[model samples]
Target: MRAAALKWVLWDVKDTLLKVRFSVGEQYCREAERMGLSLNPVAVNSAFRQAYKSYSSRYPNYGIGQGLNGHSWWTAVVKDTFSLCGVQDSALLQTLSNSLYHNFCNAQNWEVFNDSKKVLEGCSSLGLKLGVVSNFDNRLETILKSCDLLSHFSFLITSEQAGVAKPSLLIFEQALQKCGVSAAQVAHVGDHYINDYLSSRTLGIHGFLLDRDNKYDRSEVVPKGHRLNSLEELPSRLQQPMD
Candidate 1:
């Protein structure tokens, strides 16, 4: 058997592999309307960003062994999001939370990037093991399976399962142990600069920043050649000598 060029490649889920078809605020608006709360998309979106940040900051150990289940963690975010939008009724918040959570679970709401599948296949063809290290919840497995992306990965490690989020060395170390390889033998690809690239790099893992949209200003932040414009470019980049 041919020796694998790299032992494994870790991936990030949201924005990296699968993306929501509509804006978060738009999704919140539609879900809110279903729960009888009429809200402006712009206002709801703004409120959601703030609410989510506040909730996440408050509950650092949500959803994995720290005592919060998926429903509770997500419910808090949804409830806070609607409350900030001025809908204070508990009944409405509960209903909206359930609706929003399940709605997002449906695969139709997400679309995989055009280059995602082919890139995974390319890495697999190169005899590299693949895994996912994400900050999302357990529903990710269902989402990946629903999107037909589950087969390519040898493992999926989420912050929820690992008891910590990205940029946390513990989570990255958890992935390293799962793959049974040293940091130098692995590569993680994600869209976030600090969370995905720098975090992995700090742990001695080769990290590639997937900048599909070209939205980030690379000025003095990331060193040259570490930025990837698309998943299709990954294979060649991985073949080059690491810095």
Candidate 2:
């Protein structure tokens, strides 16, 4: 069945609204340099990526589901990443891990997309309720606030707070509850094909895949109307009638 017209707009944080200055690998290399580790940036980054893939695949939620705090969960990832680089110094690993964690918590490490604020303001002006549904930790709220985008949202729900991540109906349900809207009345805009688009659509929420880079291959599975090149296109898209 066709979903109801969108009334609430839920956003995904990381790539949808904000983009990091460099890869997580680059961030780790910078931290290593500051700590006086004479490492090959490329090699270290490659090792870190491999380590990250292994850990994420193993724990999925990176132990966040197992009661690991955001800081501690990330510390383990950092340590493992550096360990693969042959850095076995316990004290140094801890220091580098802590640095990486705190570094990302800073707003300077991220850049808000140029169109993000304008799109947010436009949605707000259209009387659409806005919120965030992300697989992020609480640092999401802080990041948005620092970017001056926090006031636009009615609520920010994170995986840490919801006790689950996206693609799970539970997290999206929490946002629906907080916004006082039914799934049919909301549209989720995000970059990830599965996490943002399919997940929302499967639950009867309108899904708009924000393909800013135009990277996704079009398929019959993804309705043409659901793919957007920019949030700026959202207001216009919302005005269109749903079948």
Candidate 3:
């Protein structure tokens, strides 16, 4: 058997492998309208941004630091988002919030990228181990399962479980331990510049910045060689002498 350059590939979940099928606002609008709440999608989008920012600031990492669990934390954000859009009825708010929280847990709200599964298979066939190192909550397992991606990863690590989020080296360290590999033996990939790329790079793991949207096309922070527009580029990149 040919030896692999890297022993493992640690992946970032959201936006890297899979993502919510619709924009949060669009999904919220759909749910809200079904519940008889008239709302403008644009308004919901704007409100959602504010609500999410406020919640994440006050209670980062699904609010584990504040003694809050993922459900309560996300529900609080959902409530605030709708309230900002003038949802005053407590019963209706609870219903909408609960609905969204669970709805996002499965394939009902998520979709795997076209290149994700193929890339995963490619990596596996190369004798490299695969695992996830994401900042997601506990629902990550169920989401991946629902999307038929659970089997691709040998292990899964989330911020809620790790008690720390990305951009913090602690989570990556936990993943390295679980995979039984050193930083130099693994490569990490994600869409976020700081959380996914630099954080792993700082810890001595090779990093690939997945930029499907061209969001960082001109940014000096992302190296041209490391910026990937698709996972289709990954197999080839892995075969090269990675930095």
Candidate 4:
């Protein structure tokens, strides 16, 4: 009933641990300029969202279920994003897609939250194990390594590796097996409600929904313990009960 002493803290990558320093539009426009093309960042960004959504809906989980790897899946999204912006050059789009894909592997494009490292350290100091459970590609390991955060985690279970994405209980089940821990012994923190919170909570893991922008109103419920405003609150929160 006391939740197995919360042996492990599973983290979500994007928006939870770190974020891209620039918007997709900015990254796109900058890459275009490097290739001697001119484009509006706003237009490019809007196109990226549309292309990403369409691709995700059709090919979901980088199309791992459809014989497509992360590289090919993302290349399609990038190529189509530029195509939607009217680039109309096949070779240029392909080259740009390749550039963008590899560029994201290193830490230069990402900024780890100010509180991320401290929380990770605090969790370790608490004698709790750490790991990552994200809906990311295999590039996740490289990305975290480049950021120097990979050493903190005991293991990383990416959706690309799990053959399923979050919001589905299968991914979390895989994570549980990897940690060799029961659902009651883990806590999962992520930004999305359905994918990160509800899904993990459904499996009896302590799911902490991170609402950094105050997007979800506190009056909605017992926000004091149910949701987290920052990673800084996690160490203490873990000391409390799930309810």
Among these predictions, the greatest TM-score belongs to 4
**On residues 80-127, what C-alpha lDDT tens digit does candidate 3 reach at each position?**
999999998999999999999999987979989999999999999999
Candidate 1 residues 1-243, lDDT tens each? 443347899999999998998888999998877766678999988988997787677776564555786778988888888888889889878888988888887788899999999999999888889999998887888889989999999999888877889989899999999999888889999999989999999998888898887878776235567788888998887777766
**Regions of model 2 farther than 4 Å from truth:** 1-5, 220-222
Model 4, residue pairs in steric clash = none
- Write candidate 2's Cα lDDT for 1-243 as tens digits: 675666899999899999997877777887888888777778877887787787677666646766676677778888988998889999999999988787787788899998999999998888898999998867788888877889999889988778888888888888888878678788889999989998888887888999887798867335688888888888888778743
Per-prediction TM-score to the true structure, in the order listed:
0.91, 0.93, 0.94, 0.96
Name the top lDDT candidate. Answer: 4
Stretches of candidate 1 exceeding 4 Å from the true structure: 1-5, 61-66, 217-223
lDDT of all predictions, in order shown?
A: 0.86, 0.83, 0.90, 0.91
- Candidate 2 lDDT score relative to the true structure: 0.83
lDDT of 3 at 238: 88
* Structure candidate 2, residue pairs in collision: none
User: Could you arrange the candidates by lDDT from highest to lowest?
Assistant: 4, 3, 1, 2
After superposition of all CA atoms, the RMSD between model 4 and the true structure is 1.4
